[model samples]
Target: MPAYTPPLADFTFLVKDWLKIDALYQSLGLEEFDAELALEVIEQGGKFATDVVAPLNREGDEQGCKLSNGQVVTPDGFAAAYQSYVDNGWNAMLGDIEYGGQGLPYSMAVPVHEMLNSANLSWRLTTMLTESAVLAVTKHASDELKAQYLEKLVSGQWTGTMNLTEPQAGSDLSLLSTKAEPNDDGSYKITGSKIFITAGDHDWTENIVHMVLARLPDAPAGVKGISLFLVPKFLLNDNGNPGERNALAPSALEKKMGIKASPTCVMNFDGAKGWLVGEPHCGLACMFTMMNDARFQVGLEGLGASEASFQGALTYARERLQSRAPQGVQQPDDKADAIVYQPDIARMLLTQKALTEGNRALAMLYAKYMDIAHNSSDEAHDNAEAILQFLTPICKAFMTDTGLESTSLGIQIFGGHGYIREWGMEQLMRDVRIAMLYEGTNGIQSLDLIGRKLTRDRGDMLGITRNAFAELVAGMASGEAQQHASALLDEWYQTSLQVKAFSAVDAAGGACDYLAYSGYCLLGVLWYSMADCAAQGDNPVLAAGKQKTCDFYIQRLLPRTAAHKAALLESADTLLAVEGSEFDYL
Candidate 1:
């Protein structure tokens, strides 16, 4: 495994040059969070991730988590690292100031999280879920509930978990069987078992706040009847501190392939005291506030792992002596030239670089919209919201899908070394593998994009993407950027309209391919913008790298959209024609 050096330069390029954070803050009335401050945060976060958290990655994986009795014990040094994470105020960076948070824009937290995820993903999982939980509680919880939980949660004195899955229900909440009975003291007694809960039980904090989804008695059946509840590991006492243990505990720990350091628990809540976060039957809506944030963060999870694997593979490729280059013997003094001289290796590395960097830009841009949606009072706020809703699925699905690709490329670059755990490439693959499945699987996300975002809005949201590309094309100085942007925009408009006209079955069948097409197109436009910025910037080396990567993306990867588009145009009849029993040859 190679040492994790945060991609500080790329982060700076995106935040400072491409996105123009300073100007953005001024426009959005967030004067306190300038580009300079953002850079400072990234630098310090990188240091913490490298110095404190990274060294524990391999050890944590080897040791994993230990479950004895009803409690879960994290790897050695995890608790201390988490405490340092709290002491350094990393946890509260994006929390509201009213909740003892610094009240910074969520964009500022993006790079820091990426660094953390790169350095040590297992340790980062708990914190990631905690932040998502905080968002849900902040948005929907009552004032009294906020007063009790916000301070500790924002301060990182306690952790959080999202408990939504059960034995019978996964992505489909309509099948949920958990019961929340109303109590006399205005609380609800929650009873049911929830599975696949991330960081469900941990020792890093004194208490864990679980945002659970359950059904209320007398409520309508199905997803509409589901309600959100705040179930704590420990009930609060008069002093506002953890006191009695709640009637909830981890019944079993999931034995997983990766992220072993993070506890994925089967939690059983037996008559646990909980309070409703929102109106009855509105739980799914409230939970989306958390799920949406988690989905984006999950996308970042894939990006981070991809980055780590890329760094390791690149390091190995450069130093490891191998056969001579096809062109010539680059390292005559050695037994053979380094594998870095191989053209195929270059392709793999460049592919990883383009995907990782492009996704970084996409994620950061999405974060900026999040800021605008939160801070602005004008039409920009509404537009930002629309864009966020429209891009959420793309960010989650595309980034992770490509993330898996990038990580697998890392393994291929490493050859046999990548297949083993010693090089860390396999672990990276295993860890990111789950991202495409959880937080609403990539399949689910694609359906949401084409269904809720497109059909529900009558393709109105398609204009957001179209308009953005048009604006980029109008401002682009380089001929290449203009050409690519223009062509992609035209195709995007046509494909979007075609998909919008798709019958429900056709749309459902084509959703995944459409999402892939959208992702590739979106990245193409963003790559052009990044290349344009770098081309006009002061750094020659960075400019050259960006230009070449952009060229690779445009020439090589952009062709993928054609295949996806073709698949999208295909009807579902072929798929539906196949009888279920006809495939039972096995």
Candidate 2:
């Protein structure tokens, strides 16, 4: 297994310099936080991730999780690691203080999460879902339900799962068949099966809270009838302790690629007692409160995976001897110079580094905007919310897509050795593949971006985003970086107009490409911002290195946006013209 190291320098740079989160906290009346306290938290969080959770990653992958007699048993050390995680109060880092949480800003928690994800994604999933559940219950659940469940969930003595997908209703919630019958006592009995539930059934905690979506009788048809429910694995007793077992079980587990340690279960709920959360016929809106968080965290998963892959590949390239340098025999003492001297290897490594670092900055800003949108009372809150709404799909889709690419590059760097299990390169790829598929697929995210976000209110959100990017570009010093930023902003503005026009005719055909185009341009802006920050910093080596990476990104990667733009302009007829009968080459 590859040794995992927390990228403390990169994280600190982002938090302390790039986002200036201390000022943000102060502006938001978060007087208790400062740079020192935030760094100390990050350091301790890094230690926990590095010392405890990381070692279990390969072991968990090898052992996987088991479903025995309807109970899901995670791999060895998982339960203990989880215990350590909760004992240190890491789970409550971003929760509300009223719910026994730390009430820290989301920006402060994001880096800790990134480190956790990089160390062990499977292990991270348990808490990730729990946090999302916390968000949902806090936002939409009844105050009584909150009184009963929120404290335990925020404390991490229990875990949570979002039960959305069904066997028949893949992405179409309108076709959901889950039934919720009202009881005389004002509770409901939920009866249905939900598939692809992460952390659905686990032994790490005494209880598992499931945020379920079900339909009520005598309600309108389609998604409008769906309602959110808080269903627990163990029904609460009169004293509020876990009492009788609920009528739910993990009927089976999905055995497939990636994150094997995390149980993706086929859950069966046979008249399980549950409480209604939020208003009737408004479950989809309530559930979205949680899904948005999940989507962003999933994007962080991509960033985390990419960071891990880059570290592994960089370490291997520096130590693994292969061909000599093209210019000269720099390492004549050995059989040949390390692979790091090779141009192609350097290119691959640089690509990974560029994407990882650029996305890291983007993720930080995303979290910063989230904090402002949620916590701030300033006038910027509305703009932040609009920008966040426009950027969420891009963040989730682009980051995960790049994660798959970066991990694949890790395997490619290892060559045949990468294919072997012992090298641990393949596991990263497998684990990251699910990110692209879950929390709504990248395709669906793109549709949301183009069809909904871009076109809604006649491009108001896009205007907010473009104006934000323009301000960032205005801060850049005159040179190649400034030039690149200017070009990217212009391209983004022009492309949005083009996509808006195209959507009038056919949106689906261009949605995916438009998203990719927008993502690349957005990352270009972030890279420019990083380069600008580095240029003004005191650290010579770090600044120089960042400048080089920024240049490479601008010169090499930013041009890909042009290709996506061209593709986005293509008519939908090209895709729709193909008949079902014509695809039968097999």
Candidate 3:
């Protein structure tokens, strides 16, 4: 296994060079976040990840989580590590100050989260769920709810979970059978089984707060009927101390393919006492407050996995002596040259770096927008929030998909050693694979992107991004690489408009299917502008690397957008034509 090292140089490039982190810092009102501070935090983050968390990655995976005497125990050393996290105040970095939190901006926490994910994804999942739960409680839960659960959750003393899916309802909320019958006491009795609940039960915490989605007895059907509830593992008294188990327990922990160290349990909510957060039948909206954040977190997770795999594989390639380069008479004195001598290996490594780094920049930029959306609450902040909404699915879907690709490529670069469990490359592959599936599958992400995001307003988001790109390009039309720049800018504008046209009048109908085929185009458009920013940079090395990556993207990656469009233009029947029963055997 390779030592986990944060890509500090590349982080600097993305922040200071590419996205102009100074401006973002000012935008988020963090006047003190200068280069020194940013570098210091990143360095400290690297040390914590490498020294404290990385050592636990393998041990956690091997120890997994255990159920003994009706209590779920985390892997050895997890309790200490989690306490270290709490005592150090890492959990409060992205939270609000009013709720026993530090109130540091998310721009700082995003990379920290990235390091944790790369160091130990299973351990990181626990933190990820905790963050999401806190955000949800902060946004919608009443002041009373906050007073009870906020401090402990913010301090990472007791973790949190979201209970959404059930055996009867995976993605379709209309099919949900979970019943929330109201009591005269203004609370409710939640009776349902929620599946795939991450961190559902763990000894790392004193109690678990589950943000459950269920339906009231008199509520309307479908999504409109859903309501959010705060269901705790133990009943809390007026002082917020755990009183007793509230009819919720881990019926069984899922034996998963990856992230086995984090318990994904089938939680049985058998007449659990619950407190409703926000209004009745408004649960989905409130959950989105968290899901959107979780979706972006998934993107960061994917980037971290890809970055880790690349670093490990790159180190292995540099050390392992293999066959010489394609050209003959290479390394005549030695047994063979290192794999680094091979251009293809370099190409793979560079491509992985390009994607991983680009995704990092994108994720941080989105996090910056999140801070603006939540804290600023102005007109410009509102627009940025909408843009963030449109980009969220793409970020979540593309990063994870590319992550799996990059991890697989890293494995291929190492040959049989990559597949071996000892080298840890295989674990990266397995772990990264889950991001593509969780936080709504990539297919679901695409459907949401087109059906909900674009079609609802007929190119509303597309228009915003296109107009911004054009305005930027227009400003730089006469600057360096003007010819390529001017032409691509026009193409981007045209592509945006064309995709807008792809949405039907009842745009939300089957265009979602079309989006599955053209999701890559949206990603390309975003990356095109990003690469353009870096390509037009002042630094020699970074500017050249950005230009090359953009060139590689245009030459090899952008062509996929064409296939995506063509597939979109394919009849809707291309997808619906396949009967579910017909494919059951396959």
- Across 376-459, the per-residue lDDT of candidate 1 in tens digits comes to 867888788888999999999998999899999999998998898887788888888889999999999999999989866766
Runs of candidate 1 exceeding 4 Å displacement? none
Per-residue CA lDDT of model 3 for 534-567, tens digit only, reads: 6566767876776677667666666766665565
Using Cα atoms with residue i matched to residue i, what is each candidate's TM-score against the true structure?
A: 0.98, 0.98, 0.92
Q: Which stretches of candidate 3 lie over 4 Å from their true place?
A: 328-330, 468-493, 503-543, 577-586
Candidate number with the higher TM-score (2 or 3) = 2
Off by over 4 Å in 2: none
For residue 313, model 2's alpha carbon misses the true position, in angstroms, by 0.6
Q: How far off is model 3, as Cα RMSD?
A: 2.9
Position 195, candidate 1: lDDT:
97
Model 2 residue 427 CA deviation in Å: 0.3
Pull out the clashing pairs in model 1: none
